[model samples]
Target: MDEKVVRYKKNSNDIHVLPPSPYTEVPKPNVRREKLSVENEETIQTKKKLEKTKKNFLFDPRRKTFLGRSSLNWARLAAFYTVFYFCLGMFFVILLYVFALILDREVPTYYNKDSTMAVRTTATVVGMGFRPQPMVDDSLIRVSNDLYEQKRIASSLRLYRDVYLIQKTDAKAEPCTELDPASELVPGTACSFSWFDIVSTQDHPCSDNNMYGFKHEEPCVLVKLNKVYGWTPTKGPLPIHIQGLRNIHNNKSIAKPDVYITCDGTNPSDRDAQTEMVYYSLEKPSGSSKYGVIPNYYFPYRNARDHVQPFVLVQFKNLPLHRLISITCRAWSPGIEHETRGMRGMVAFQLYRSQVAEKLIKDDN
Candidate 1:
């Protein structure tokens, strides 16, 4: 059908034109992603700031800062301590000087008669001491008659040998001279101690050959009065008021004032044991004399220079055999009465016979 229907030529513009896609413009970067990136950057900056702060806190050497300030403070504290100690030392020295000024160089601050206050309040009293005190036990004299114990006694005597020998030298000048019977008791006129007379004879109480009587059954006890600063016993007869009836009857004349020593058995049961003991040289064998323990003029100890301490050597002529006796010896003076303290100026000891001492040793073993 060749009909004249001519196909209409498709126009170039008639071809379907595609519309621009909706996502074509490369969609603007996501807004959320941009915000996330910015946040990450801020977080990193904050971490760095924290690290810097921690470093500064640990040890900052900056002037007027932590470590620097601490060092300066320690130095100031040390300087303060040094100055404080120096001032304290100076104050102590000043106080010592003041104390020294108050004290006397030659004399004691509080002593016998010199200090009236001390005399009334303090009352300086001294006791007696005995040499050859028991070495093993002070309370008991446990010397046996056996050879061993006798040797021990000899050793004790030797300890004081030098002291006894001191008399040989003139180191101690005579302090007293023989008193004239006509004159009143004088300071320098009292009879001096004759060391040779006391110790030269073999039969004497303190003879060197006898080991001061340790070898013999008889024993010599040396007694020394304790020393008190500036104290002197009055040199005169014991006041008549202080004299007992016995003393008055025995010493009717009262011409010689003397210090008497009495040794008595403390135990009533043992009193008989002391009956045989006698005080030697109490009087001249030919005539009656005053009690003799120490002479009156030897007293008033005038310092260490002019006077030597006078000691009495007591000899036990007949100590009880194989028995124990308690003996108490005392120094009697008018002003010096029995005192509760220091055994009332008395010394007491226990005397053990050889057999008793040996038995005691065996029992102890």
Candidate 2:
């Protein structure tokens, strides 16, 4: 055993390494290889899943722009109705203008009438600047049984003539003397026919000594009628008489006499006495000379009060009147005709205004 052991010292490069044995396969890198393969496969599968998720979440620009246009179209439709409502507001403005033109035209009517019988009347509405004609209404004609009497007399008498008288011419006076008896003409001696000579004819008979008697017998009958045309030969005031004479008289003086009339049966001749004939003088309000007589007193009973109704008012006019005070009134009677009398029942009388009658008086003095 000792003799078989031989020791060999190998050089650094001289030792040849034997190749791995083919029968004893190389030790496979089993765990690491398996791990590397599994890791690579898992990475590829995760990348595939990320690509699918990105495709599902995709948004298109064209589809978003289309939706924005649809919203603008809806906004435009809403604005159109607002403009249409503003345009429809003009219809009310035209209607108000038409109503203002109808209120600017009108007329006034007045009816005035006077009658003796009962008749219904109405006023005809006429146009401006013309008087309205009254119409008869037959529904209100009835007379009340109130009868009265009224008398009227002349207030004044006027005359135009020269005065004369019958007298003899004095022989001792101048031959051509003037015999003026309140006459404008002078009678001379050369005057052949005297007033007596011409009036003594048979045609003008002065047989009656009565001053009021008239005989138309002479051509100078007009002269005789003047002297005899006075009132009854009463001792009171003589009636006014005027004569026309061209010749002059010897002693008689011609004078003008004042005339008068009375409603109460009395004669007044003095210049101061004319006041008695005046029933009412505008100067005095009440007294003996003042007659407070209303002109409408002659109306029937029911009609009498009609003039006195409260609706009537009298209005005075004119600054200064001669002898009468003028007053205006508004009448309100319906004037309906009565069934029985076939006449109007009452007349309407309305007084507009009144004042003191003295405003119209003028003193003769």
Candidate 3:
């Protein structure tokens, strides 16, 4: 029976499962998926924390922080800038006080004749200005095609009218009987400017009838010297013969120096074309007319209250219609120096007659 049982067991186990093979494969852990799940959880937590921080930034004032800065931090920053600017302002004030100490209050510290600095640097000794300059910020005079254009013509006349009225109404001014070239002008004396003599007649032009010579195509330009305090014109080198004649002619009386004015056309080509152009008072002999452009002794312009500007009237007899003419006027005196760059002691301007009226008339047809 033992032998039979042994045989049955052997036969039954004939298809026996062998022990597990050494080459059998085992399942691997999903490490990549586990790592991704851990990263996602951490990202979610970080996002939640950022949102909470943003909410605190917006709503939580008691948190004592705003956009990563506290209110106390901002206040300290502002206070720092305030103190910095205050110190800067104090420094500027100190600089200004030091500058004031170096300068004179009444007189110019660096511009006077005795100034060593002024001697080293080229200074403007004279200034020239003109009136009846209709356009703002401009010195040129433009006349319209039509003489009676009220807007254009009246604008120029209005300035002259105001000046005329002022001169007429001022009772304190002494009657300027003559603009003597040989006379010495007293500094404080207010001489009469014969406004009527130049602008009163139709023959000479510059009258109400002629609209100050604008209607007649003979416009008047009034030139004035800028005021310089404590400065006087020097006697220029006079011609020897003229000086000898004056010395011989006037024995006892001192020979008075004259401020001569000359107006020339800037265009060398067109200079001959406008030969009729002349200075009204200068056309006559010296001391004959009281209305010279620049009179003798019209210097050392005092304050505005006590002094009137020394002015000359320049009249153009005829101008080329609808054309531009560049003209320059110069003041010659020993005390004044001509400057090439600026309008000192000299002024240049263009005279233009508008062809717009003619263009408009042609366009209408």
Which candidate ranks first by TM-score, i.e. highest? Answer: 3
Judged by lDDT against the true structure, how good is candidate 1?
0.58
Backbone clashes, each candidate:
0, 30, 4
Write one digit per residue (lDDT tens) for candidate 1, span 1-365.
12222233476434454555555554456899999999999999999988866666655655434533476776898899999999999999999999999987655776675555245334446577666774645766654556567667767766665654244444434545335321233333322344343454666655667766666767766666765554545444564533762445333434445556666688787787774543443232111122236665555453433234556666665676778888877777653555545475678877776653668667665
Candidate 3: C-alpha lDDT: 0.59
Q: Rank the candidates by TM-score, best first.
A: 3, 1, 2
> In candidate 3, what are the lDDT values of residues 269-290, reduced to their tens digit?
5576554654555335222222
Model 2: per-residue Cα lDDT over 102-185, one tens digit each:
543221121123232213434211111100111133211111111110000000000100112223344211111123211222
What's the TM-score of each model vs. the native? 0.60, 0.12, 0.62
For model 1, the run of ten residues with the poorest summed lDDT:
282-291
Clashing pairs in 1: none
Error at 261, model 2, angstroms? 99
| lDDT leader | 3
Which scores better on TM-score, 1 or 3?
3
Misplaced by over 4 Å in model 2 are 1-13, 17-25, 31-48, 51-365
User: Model 2: number of clashes?
Assistant: 30
